[model samples]
Target: MTPAQHNTPAFHDLFATHPRLTGLALAPDGTRLIASGQTSDADGTGYVPGLWEVDRAGDDGIRPVTGSGPGDFAPAFAADGTLMFLSGRDPGERGGTGDVALWALPERGAARRIAHHPSGIATFAVAAGADTVAYTAALLPGATDAESHGRLRRARKDAKVDAVLYEAGPVRAGGDGEPHTFVRHADGAPMDIGGQGLAGNGDTALSPDGSLAAYTRAPTDQAPDTNCVVVADAVTGAERHVFSRAGNQYYHPVFTADGSALVCQRQREETHDTEWRVTLVAFDLASGAETDLLPGFDNWPWPGRPLPSPLPGDGTLWFTGDEQGHCPVFRRDADGTITRLTALGAYGSLCVTPDATTLYALRGAVDGPPRVVRLDVAAPDQEPVFLTAAGGLEPLPGTLTEVRTEAEDGCPLRAWLALPEGASAERPAPLVVVPHGGPQGSWSDWPWLWNPWPFTARGYAVLLPDPALSSGYGQRMQRRGLGGFGEVPYRDVMALTDAALGRADLDAARTAMAGWSFGGYLAARTATLTDRFRAIVSHGGMWNLEAFQMDTDMSAYFRKLFGDPRTQRERYEADSPHLDAAKVTTPVLIVHGGEDHRVPTGQALGFHNDLRRLGVPVRFLYFPDEGHDIGVPNHIRVLYETMLNFLDHHVLGQEWRRPPLL
Candidate 1:
């Protein structure tokens, strides 16, 4: 296919239907590679992820391994050449609509269901040299076997209890159920390993020899606010104490190659002033020794990137860390030494060959979208070998360039500028400035959720600027917005936006702004502070700081940023956007996920209500099924559609209309 076939002046279907590749899995022998990706469903209402076998050299076109009707993932090869994966193919799950079960596909036969659990399996691992499998399942308290678990569940349903007694755990609005890791040999009896795993979790790992499993146990009544990393013997179900520090949280436990150590990330608040930086940690099994990997290493694991990008093999661990505007690969040897292997761009969704000779990852930068690449172990920083054609992606709809500016305080700032074709001094394109989230995050890499390609296709220029709170800039830049999210970052954003507007091809009069999370908060704050832009959109932003402090998951974390509402009321009033909602004159679009606990739905609902009460032009979009990030494909489609429609109506002076979401 050609770029012309996919790109057009009108709404491009490519944006909605393009194949998205993620989660790569390498076979034990290094000869076969399997990948999992989501494609547009038949009804075009959602996405279904399926497994595909990728040719090592990309000679043969990628072939689909299993049908897309049922979502499949985590494809692992067993020692007996049996491939096992988790899927939601069966409708007879334990009352959960989309609960997953283990399915096996032999070397030369069709796939069939291999195992089933009452509360459904969350994650699983196949033994490398042994014929055992380990997975996590939610069993009823005081119930051992699946049958007893089911009986107790039935009794609980029959009684119809509404209140739950207090046992210390994460406070959320739902039933309090715990997931426990279970081990079993393939086609044999399963044994329950007593450790409280997170519901719908993914931080469990099984050793290569199938003798040990490492998992993160959520804090219980005894330890109210601390996560415990427990390593248990698979066959005996004997738990041992590794290393844990007070006031520290551990997660993403993976067994070392020799099965004598566990590698994971440690998050702690060393002080009350600064944000936590997750560092690599190792816990030895034999001596119960704790080793801090990359001691004093400034960089952290790629923020907001799901799944640890590196895999450990052959007594070595390899992973990605964010450093100086790039998320590169780092290798850790057994002797407590670390080396940087790759540079210059962000890397994620990584896997390594069985022999550990080559590394594979989906890499991208501000100029391009993610594409699969292969790198040699010896010299990973060398030019990458593109493994796939990336579904023959179309040519860039616009030109991408970089912009540099300095804040009033003399802090240097960087931004990425996307200008549509035919933009010139005589005909400047309308601009949309997008600030990143985390306030601690940067726009150093390409973003799938906030892709600028669509804006460029519509003859608009998108400016992604990183302000004082951005990473990769150094500690001084990070500390600039520590307790004052509304002050320093605001100045930094205005500086960069003013610089971008100075360009001959950008139209400041017709500009708009949009963002999600902290980005969304900044957009709302910007709208309240100035009337330069025509419109504003805030997706899942915190509008009321005092109210948000109570509803969010990390209440303590938010408290650390902005002090207690009673003690530091002035700061709350100074930083919050909703407290000054009456000053917001710009037309606004407020979008939020109803199930979001991070920046609760009330944040958007309250803001929209206030804007309406103040006689301001505003609209609200809510997705009940989505969480912090909108994951459902159908909701994502509507989100992209509504955002464009809102921008077109206000910024481009088109007729005001609403999308089909009543």
Candidate 2:
């Protein structure tokens, strides 16, 4: 089909109805490839999740690997074409309990479960040789006092049983916590090397020989200022501080072929914005001295561009960087000289062939789904081989325009405006002000994977403003809303809305606010703070700080954001949206996952109950089987449809005037 025909409404309908492709793996021999993705088939009135596999060769072999429904992922190829992956029997199961099992794919069409768990498996990984399978399974409540612990297990290719290697416990002074570990086994059973700790998020890298491990560790209490690389001997589990930094976060560590040094991406803080630079630093294992191979490498200055993966070689690294608005691959030689490789679109997760002659990359835009591409870096001018089209997904044509507006205090705030095609300046459109989740995170140009398009298609304008606490800027800007959660960030959002309303095409009276998590908290708080918005929608948001502190899973994390609620009771009370529920005049809709352990279901229900008691117009929509965010396609459809109807009723004053619960 022609490119234009492939993007038609009929094509979009087919594409949206299909499953999404996620994890990809290349075999050890580099001659074979295994891909794992989900599919949904209609069963009576609903759809069920299924697993599928595809062979890169063999007459375009693509077929279902599992017979029944459940979600399957994390597919890896074992030695001699044996495939191993995780699967579950029920898609709706949660809280560590469900029939999740480890299955083996002997070939393209045959599969069988080898290990079964009454609870469920969260994640799994297979060694390169495939003889050893390592996985992390959640121990159910009866099995442990802690809510959840990632227990590591390994199995042999010939053995009929599996053995527990390590179980993650609470963080000890020098011991590993949960298995944030990445296993790279060259021979024998997989080694137990890493675990979750301060390591910024869960980025871990193994040495070339699988004898050493390098990872980043951040401070637990606060948003980490700087993270250091801790190198440990894989055999003895002996650890040593290899590299350290003061205020920057070093992420995605990669070991050199010789295992003498490591390369990582460094994010440095600046005023009003954070600049990302990729530096190749070589750390001497013996001397513990870090030498900068190449410093100050900007991965394309434009927002949302990720640094290219380091090429697999010693003294030479192949990585992607954005330069002059286009993403291109660059080769940084041992001598610090760099050369451009390919002028492809934004790409990530570079998988080099075992021979190191070719590289496989995924390229796409935010609105555009990812497509796999195979590039022969040796032939720099040759066109890349396209393995698949984002499997029928079309790119939603839109542009994120950045605008700087002054806050009430005259501080410059950054905002992104996504304008729909054929929109005019004269036609005033309803505005949907979307605040980001992290009071500390910035809104970039990443494609909106959710329902922003549906809103824009219906002639609404979406506004995203980066308040004082946003991180892309610098430390000072991020700290601006540290304790001013209810004050400065709220004001910044309002000022930006007022500025947008000043535009001829923005309908000031038809504005609404929506957010998820912290953004949800802001939206709820804003409704009470002002009567400007006609409606508001909050997803996984906090209602009362006091209740949230007691009910939410991350009480310790919240303590840092608002201080200890016991000692800072007045401060928490002052910053809570629940305190002013009676003042919320605008109609509000609360959406949440029933099993959301992160924010907890109590927060959403508490707000709904309070609003009802106050005689305010509000409605609650809960997905019983979902988590912090809605993942199932059918549920997402329901969420978008409900939101659209809610917006239509309030912003357009059409058909329905108010929800039944409201």
Using lDDT as the measure, the top candidate is 1
List CA RMSD, all candidates.
3.9, 8.1
Off by over 4 Å in 1: 1-12, 66-69, 91-98, 155-166, 173-176, 197-200, 220-225, 269-272, 303-315, 333-339, 444-446, 660-662
Look at candidate 1 and give me any clashing residue pairs.
none
Local error of candidate 2 at residue 307 (angstroms): 8.9
Per-residue lDDT of candidate 1, residues 67-115 (tens digit): 3234887787777767788887764432224557887877677777777
lDDT of 2 by residue, 72-92 (tens): 666666656666667764333
lDDT of 1 at 455: 73
Model 1 residue-pair collision total: 0
Q: State the lDDT at 267 in candidate 2.
A: 57
Looking at candidate 1, what is the lDDT of residue 490?
Answer: 85
Q: CA lDDT of 366 in candidate 2?
A: 32
Evaluate residue 402 in candidate 2 and report its C-alpha lDDT on the 0 to 100 scale.
54
What's the TM-score of each model vs. the native? 0.90, 0.70
